[model samples]
Target chain A: MRIITAEQISAAVAELCIRANRELPEDIVSAMNRAAADEPWPVAKNTLEVLCRNIAAAEEMELPVCQDTGMACVFVRLGQDVHIEGDFRAAVDEGVRRGYELGYLRKSVVADPLRRINTGDNTPAVITLELVPGEKLELTVLPKGFGSENMSRLAMLKPADGVEGVKRFVVDAVRKAASNPCPPVVVGVGIGGTFDKAAALAKHALLRPIDCPNQDEFYARLEEDMLREINSLGIGPQGFGGHTTALGVNIETMPTHVAGLPVAVNISCHVTRRASMEL
Target chain B: MEYRLKTPVNREELNRLRAGDMVYLSGEVYTARDAAHKRMTECLDRGELLPFEIRDSAIYYVGPTPEPPGRVIGSAGPTTSGRMDAYSPRLLDLGQKLMIGKGLRSREVIDAMVRNGAVYLAAMGGAGALMSACIKSARVICWEDLGCEAVRLLEVEDMPLTVAIDSLGGNIYESGPAAYLESLKGGK
Candidate 1:
């Protein structure tokens, strides 16, 4: 069995938290560049240019790309053969604590929803673990900001509603979001499974590279169709009005109960920050 | 078109502004997010003095990241402004004339702006690193215990913004997209 220490996991999470905040992923950068090139509105083009400059400044100055450094979301893939030493959950939280403090990233978490006291350390990261067949442990850190998170939506439709219903819900959600989530957003769609599973799948869909297509031919085509319809809304960059409302659309699906069809749309802004490492 | 604006912008100046106009704001501005706004409105309700002046001043809805060494401030950008909708009308009634942030505001907020001759400007959302370059200095004015949610006094130079709502209730959030969608149809 491959052994991994809690300390190693903590240190890796810390580094990832800092790195993911400052750097724009290459796929996102490329997608934005393409959108800027194709955008028809001068105002929208200008907005994209400013976003590019922001990315550069963040990288050069070693500052966060956005002030809302976001909630720490860590996804872990552990091989069945690997055994971890020490408290796993505690290590993840420790990493978040150190990362937020050391990186000078914003501590955005509140202790409770209604009471509203700052957590100060941005701790207790949202972690998802999956077991795979290997000796390696893989970790991905995504700092998700709330502006887009607030705009995400989920709907449970009758089985008869099908693909058309899903499309309508997604398009309506994006329209309702308008400029709130930051336009030129990446849309992660999860279809099928149970209600909660579909929501999780939608978020997981966002982790895929922007240009990558879904493995399923049907879902890939749905993604493309959704992308076209969303851009047609003319929300543009920052909702100034243009042809590039969305940079990409990603869809993930699973088998669902015969009674219901569930779908979730998790919107992410242009600076879709995520980082991964294997050990 | 771009205009260089100084704080405590007069009624005449605000009236002249319209949705979609680009602006570069300078001089003194204040920072307050959801928590601070709630506190301020509560103080107003209690007939208590505000921590800072509200008349003709611009408030930025932002809760910035902590400053690193040798920097006056950290990455600072606008938070979603819709969250502040509940408190904005009251603040506008108290003579808060300008707001800088991102996203849509409620009908009541827009009505308050039209009634009070205030304006709303949007800094590019998520453009924190670039936006920080324009902020010359920042220091907390109150609620330091709230951490980043504290009210701050900031001096900015040429802070870029686009007019999202004007004194007359012209809203770019609605009109910009509508116009573009129409143009798309026409082009086709």
Candidate 2:
């Protein structure tokens, strides 16, 4: 069995948080370059240009891409053979606290949804775990800003809605989001499974690289179609006007009960930030 | 029309602006978002003075990242303005003339801006690192306990913005997309 220390995990998590906030992934940069180069609307083009500049500035100046540094979403893929040496949850929260402080990131979490008291340190990260067949532990930290998070939606459709209904719902979600979630957004969609499972799947779908399509031929076509339709809405870069509303559409699905067709759409802005490390 | 606004912008200056006008602002502004607005409104309810003057001043709906060493402020960008829709009308009633934010505002907030001869402008959303370069100085003025959500007094120079909603009730959020769609229909 591979043994890992809590301190090592925490330190790694802390660095991941800081690095993810300051750097734009390469695929995202390429997508932005394409959008900025080909956008037809003058205002939309300008907005895309500014977004590109922001990406560069974040790295050059060692500053975060957006002020809303967001809730730290740490995804862990652990091998069944690995054993952690200490209190894993506390170590993760400590890492989040230190990273938010050291990186000068915004602490956006509230202690309770209703109480509205600031957490101050941005602790208790939303951690997701999946078991894989290996001796290595893989970690991915995604800083999810609420601006786009607030626009995410899920609906349990009747089996009758089928694929067309899923497309309609996803498109409508993006349309209703408009300028709010920040256009040139990434749309992550999860179909099938139970209600909650679909939402989680939709969110994880965003972790896929922007240019990569689902391996399934049918789903890949659906992704391409949905992306085209979203851009056609003319929401543009910052919702000013044009044809570059979304950078990419990612879909992930699983088998579900025959009675229900649960679909979830999770929107992410141009500031889509994630970083990964393995140990 | 492209214009430069020096803050404490008067109603006359704002009156000349229209939705879709590109603007560069150079002057002082205060920053606030959902929590700060709630606090300010509650203080208003108790007849308590706010941390900053409301009349003729601009409030940016932003909660900035903490400044690192050698920086004036961290990535400072506009948050979604629609979240502030509940308290904006009240601030507008007090003669708050300018608001800097991103995204849509509610119908009532637009009506309130129209009533008060106010204007709402948008700094590009998620372009925080680029936007922070425009802020020359930033210092927390109140609610220090709120961390990034604290009210900050900022001095900005040549901060680029677009008038999303104007005093006369023109709204770019609704109109910009509509115009683009219409142009597409016209085969542009």
Q: What is the lDDT of residue B81 in candidate 2?
A: 95
Runs with alpha carbons beyond 4 Å of true place in candidate 1: none
Local distance difference test, each candidate = 0.93, 0.93
Model 2 clashing residue pairs (backbone): none
Per-prediction tally of clashes: 0, 0
Question: Which 10 consecutive residues of model 2 chain A have the lowest summed lDDT?
Answer: A234-243
Candidate 1: give its CA RMSD in angstroms. Answer: 0.8
Residues A1-279, candidate 2: write the lDDT tens digits. 999989988999999999999998999999999999998888788889889988998899899999999999999999989999999899889889999999999999999999988988998799999999978989999999999999999999999998899999999999999999988899999998998999999999989998999999999999999999998998888888788999999999999998999999999999998999998
